[model samples]
Target chain A: MSNKLLLMGDEAIAQGAIDGGLSGIYAYPGTPSTEIMEYVQNTKQTAELNIHRKWSANEKTAMEAALGMSYAGKRAMVCFKHVGLNVAADAFINASITGVNGGLIVVSADDPSMHSSQNEQDSRFYAKFAMVPILEPSNQQEAYDMAYFGFELSERLNVPVLLRITTRMAHSRAGVQRREGKPQNSLRLPSDPRQFVLLPSIARKNYRKLLMGQAAMEIESEKSSFNELISGNNKSLGIITTGIAYNYLVENYPDQKSPYPVLKICQYPIPRKQVEELYNSCNKVLVLEEGYPIVEEQLKGYLNTGKPVHGRLDGTVPRDGELNPNIVAKVLGMDVAEGQPIPDVVKNRPPSLCQGCGHRDVYEDLNEAMKVYGTGRVFSDIGCYTLGALPPFNAINSCVDMGASITMAKGAADAGLVPAVAVIGDSTFTHSGMTGLLDAINENSPITVIISDNSTTGMTGGQQSSATGKIVDICRGIGVDPNHIRVVTPLKKNHEENVRILKEELAYQGVSVIIPQRECIQTFARRKKSEKKESND
Target chain B: MKNDIILAGVGGQGILSIAAAIGLAAVNSNLYIKQSEVHGMSQRGGDVQSHLRISDKPIASDLIPEGKADMIISVEPMEGLRYLPFLSNSGWLVTNITPYMNIPDYPDINEILAKVKSLKHHIAIDADSIAKEAGSSRASNIVMLGAASLFLDIPFERIEEGIRQLFGKKGDEVVQMNLKALRLGREFSEKNR
Candidate 1:
């Protein structure tokens, strides 16, 4: 029987990891990458195989935990969005140096055009900086195949492999044929006693080993089936495509035949031999990459290669955003008829907090309270509450990275922006706000911190939050006065009371945390539905 | 045969269910399918769309090229117009007449309807009423899918089986309600078109 299933690219990666004998999959929820872990968590195969699937507090914790699993001689995979890589950079770079006893694949889903992200930073640069092999899947099938291939490559080279994907590659669905399941590796420790230790003397040896492995990694990229040079008769213009960009190129050529010789590179390390061959044969080259112009920039260094290489830098492609078949068709000089301009009658509909959302109530109360304190004092973190910066409320002043709310508020307070406030979600607070809270307590930084406790992550589809029932204890543990750490239910009826509590906290000279405790409306609705089903039964 | 469709709706409107039924049907027919979905922040209440492509040959891009979509099946009238740029000149616009008025500045219902009605090829149905008539208003997405199934290259029976397979875990009652919703929608389209 054919074991074919229709799966999203994220689900394909999860199923691939399972079939590839994954012992554990660790992640902190973020878009385009969240579904990978969610799929693993919900799948029957993982439960039957006893695979460890749990949400980590943050990307750094997830990366370190996956590294630790690899240290135990069991295959582990860590998944996160592109920006999450910034949080895990320290551990990620060092992991390459420490290498691995078991296979480790770090899946970083990049969001081009800022789809669900604050920025459009490509993850391939990080892999290049760490000098590890990178697997960029061009489609759903490749996304699945890469997991199995990445694990083997990771084990073969004794290094962690980076599997990079963009939003389209992660969220798109296609049919994927499954491979036979492999048995999980039994629990065992690394053979080298001092391998994971980063003592300076050992570090030098590890760094040298990583630096030396670049050649072998390059060799692997050259021979990888994922990266290939398709022959074409026309040699006037060659093309180099990475990741899903290759799909756009093929999409323009429906016959699956481009007139120009194309170097389809889904593996990193440049695969210099194939690239050089293509570059040498064609009179000019066009580089197509999804996110950044890493390949284009590399191919055209400070001293330009005489052959006119064109890409983002040269304006052959629009400098930013994702590539679609229309863009490729236009670039290839093919006529494209984009149907019609949307009539002006269509109004823009931005995402807003749900009507009954606790975050909406909190923002309403916060906006009302902030009227007395004046505006431009609220620093918010990444979450659904970040939506407070928009629309009817327009409450928050800044929406930076996760956990930046508290620290930025403290810094602003230090700069004499007195009565500065930080509003963060419960999940984000536990993710990184706890440390900033500790800092505020140590010096008594006069910043009012509002931990909008929704009891679930609320953003990225309500994953289990580590701070679900422990926010009060955590605040008390962090040395904030019990009296100052007030809690309130964010509801319409309690609006005045919540505002009074907020005013008290803002008046305090020391650190104060006001947690508005309410269940997320979406999750609450889901619970009600399930509960009603149970009652009906 | 190849068919590229754009499923459009407001988030939380159950458009993914519509995409799931069609995807399942395409898979059952042994057609190559690729569907690109929107997730994360915009899913709160913003406009959400899915690019669904099915072909006898292997599909390449997850997104349909501009002006290449064979049909746009939207659960909301205004949401359908949002993807007009992706529709081919001859593409069909199958949308529900329901106005998901989450936004403050939603256009007049008649204005949106006039725009939809002005299209060369379009099917605007009161899927909510049809679904309710079929025993469940929650199956409006399935109704929208069925209204669109007329233009889809796949067989009608395949789509019925697809809905059955999709709602099977929810029990036979739910499946039967959705199947009834599907038939009512197809009936409405057959009468009107």
Candidate 2:
């Protein structure tokens, strides 16, 4: 069992967290980051240890819960995708002021190429803004090793550690070696009384302490094993790689040797001294990073020393999209082999809502009902229902961030767009939509909010939704008129009746909610399959 | 002792099982392997591709560069053609002839098959029928994998063992069905070539 195991970077991080004495893990399901929690949940060790592995309602709640576990003197890890970090930014930014008694690791899986994400926002900026130590692994082994030692680093520095990974690192599978396990920490309060309290007098003092602690954090980064300086034979061009970009750089070199002085900066605060070494040793500098040119931008400071700094900011590298070995080779001025282009016979195959999905039925019925009102009035949240923006359905208008549907619809309704509809998933409703629903109800906004209840988080592979079987109670609790809150089964046979219900909700002057409740088709099939297998056994 | 493979197919087409089988065999042979997969939104019936690399030497990038793939192995016909840009000039294109028409604008099956046949090194297999003969239509992905196995440098018996190890949890009957499916697919490819 101690031998090398084939694991995805996310799985490796989960194993490392478990082996490194994790007492709790919290996360809201999002792509690239979802597998980290799913792996921990599926593992036998976490279950045996009775570790807290339940999904949180949203990323902010997840972040706070993890901080709470850390407050009780136990190692905790909070994971989410790049956008989820935006949701958790409030707690994440303040955690640095109120240092921790136990280790805390915040894992942010970024999507640089907009792969399964709306925007290519970098999570490193969030870490930097919070003034926390960052760990960006270059490979699967480092991903595991960082998680293994990251807790100690966090505890030693008395601050939360940020483990930032991109989509490639999160989803790629490689062999990872295991490390010796550490025992879980016992529950104990922080030695400093009033540390968690953020009163202005104490908060001002804590903020100063955090500012003073930056030097120590940078020193730890300077000495981190993940940060290495490799001296090369040539000095014409010095290359700096952060995270998985290091792999793409070394991939062009089969001998695993680059001609220029290379500073592999996985641990951050830029590891100032090593960067200075590389900057001084070579004539020109090239910074390769997966997402934004964070390091590159820093190197080319306000008053440049006139040393050439080439990266995404300049035309040296493509400003957008993810980096690949071919891109690296091209930038290195190497001849890359051009393959045959795909024939015209192959067409675009964008992701679509699965056939027989409840979202599809909801979209069909809603589209039919919206024919009179016309399109561009249905505001949708993030989920499978977002695909309704595509052809065949052409139902929804906007697919902004989660919970934006109801709030945006309310705003639009406030702007004289009457009966603006909001299409949201059940899981999303609990995540952040409930509060918006409350706002709409209090204002009596004339918006038809469609809570397309799928009973599970369908987009990120059917995680247990926080709002399963509770939509009706939630709506009632939000003060929506019970009569205006209607439930309809979204099926082809019930399409006519479902359309009628939607139309009625749309016509209402006050706030109205339509719940199209059905289990996800994929999850339903899986449940039926397992049930059949059980009966057979 | 290196093979760069691109596994392409529509989501829910079971290409991951094909990847699992190949990955197990590669790991069993003590080779270094890296597989990059598409997850989340792409799994709900979208075009998905996995870049799989196995080598005697340590692999660096999880992704394979364009025009360097040793083979384009697909469980669906058009899916195979979609990755032709990644396939090497001498590389083989092994694909199932069956069409997965989930999209509304899917091209004609005959034209897709004709394009596949135009390639110098290709194996267009009726793996659906072959899998049906082997006792389960669900094993079509395995059949496609079996056809692609001929060009793979790994030993054939190791692939059989891989299927056993991968599906061992499902019971012996399922494994046996897949083994038969693999064999039928291999025999068809051998005769056709």
Candidate 3:
């Protein structure tokens, strides 16, 4: 055995992919999941592994590249954050219909509680919708093992696998069992060219095959060793836990002795036979799963024994809010120690943009402009800058998703709203906002779209956005008047100038785009440190 | 026996390293251990925390419930106080006395310190100063962890071995400096006790 090493969950996934004989990894940088690709790219030892790694233009492109590689009879992996999945939804859903020729794994790292994300969306539901298998790992080791196994399972089932990890699982470092690398799979062109061709008739036939394949898929899940039954003598209660929820259930029942059978499922869709057997064995089956009641709902339908399945559906577990051990214990009728009362150590600490953050200056100027116009006139997109909706800088009115700001502002303008402003990050504007800008230009909507160009994807880790140096050019290409597209630094030093420029844009009649150019504080700090080293040398 | 520990600090404060060290120690002791951590916003100086569960049997959860943690180790005083809800009434809190001001608005730093001092079962150490004395401020996390190690069943030798395994390749000087800081922290904690 090799010496033990501390590896982050993302790094472990990368290592697992290499060990699983990955031929290629295609991805775009996003928080929590960015390191997976970065690690593979930077590791000197990986050169001998014959891995083809590329940073795709966006999540959709990244996914399609991996699909193409998989179709060539090579194992491939693609990764992106939760919201990036939305950009890749079209490719992801279609791949389900056109089965895989080789191992293919899609790694989606979801940001819950809106930590560095547009919304706290769980990506497991996406897997469910696509009718594909999903694997959620609780810790670093499982993350590594599941990533490797997920690819194997993908090829076995002739389908792509969704390996959903969360913020907690992506970044956390733990001891992973290191394995020797495997030889890269040789590239073999698709034997059946018709499988790659997707006409309406062929697509319809493939879609039916996908539906018919579900029965065997369920049977495969039942026989899989990942789904196990942990039992006690208690027949009055049974708990069905999946992914991280299984971890919570174990922690909650540490000291309690209950007559219940616990079904721990790390893989999905959960085995219907296991749920049916669990229902037959217990009076009530309590479903414990994070994100949504995917397993619980299926159990409710599969268990014909008339046994009550309690979970988020029946309000046993709160429908909203993240679940922890205490919440699980409370539901399980277990006694948890009472925590010491907080002695009002400090007031509630609401998250805010960092001091000297470009977002701060941008919001300050935006707020001033809003005061000049009217409140509730600005539409915001997702990013670290979206915190402008909070107190001390109540600048933005609505924030739906990544590129919704531009569309929302255009919609408002079409509805006869005056001085409509759209606030979006430079990275987000490139991700999906460009299309919205095209629509705005086509309709000649009288709205101002403010692209907060921090030169990085600030909401997630500071990764390079695709439109870093090309915001002005992109806007010009999209038909926004070059003269109307103004750029300014959003800083305390440039506060007056930024506000003046914003005011001018708001007053302009046609579709105007404001490019606020500044660097994120974290990236700026890193740059300063590197420059200092260079200077010292 | 099951031992659950929670480590809290600002992002980039080496909270995960402490958990890794503890996890490594457990692995060395031939115990089953499970640990989990928060990722996003962790690099942005946000409140980052980790749970390390060590048991003779398999660990069920990667998270420890409020008041169930036997020990709460923190790299920052404010972070320690922020996670007070997770500490058992009888649990011990070993943390650095240094305060980290979070982004957005926060209460007076002194007020936060006062509240932490008033809380029972707390031990405050100038871990940052110790680490600085050892020639690097980043080692403060290791120092705080060394202070907290006095309460855990895991032996200091195991911790040292884990540290060696983690950072042994960084060079002898770096390893020796951290070892010195850890020893100094242990001595200070023993003197305080």
Candidate 1 chain B lDDT trough over 10 residues, lowest sum: B184-193
TM-score of chain A of 3: 0.93
**DockQ, candidate no. 1:** 0.77
Off by over 4 Å in 3: A1-5, A29-32, A111-120, A253-259, A302-305, A531-537, B12-14, B20-32, B42-45, B55-57, B102-105, B108-111, B128-139, B158-177
Kindly give the stretch of ten consecutive residues in candidate 1 chain A with the minimal lDDT sum. Answer: A1-10
| lDDT string, candidate 2, A250-353, tens digits | 88886778887899999989899999898888999998889998899999987766699999999799999999999999999988876789899999899999
Q: After superposition, how far is residue B26 of candidate 1 from its true place, in Å?
A: 0.8
Docking class of 3: acceptable
Clashing pairs in 3: A234-A259, A234-A260, A247-B61
> Which scores better on DockQ, 1 or 2?
1
lDDT string, candidate 1, A134-159, tens digits: 99999888999999767889999989
Candidate 1 clash pair list? none
Candidate 2 lDDT over residue span B40-103, tens digit each: 8888899999999998888888998888899999988999999988888999899989888988
TM-scores, one per candidate = 0.99, 0.99, 0.91
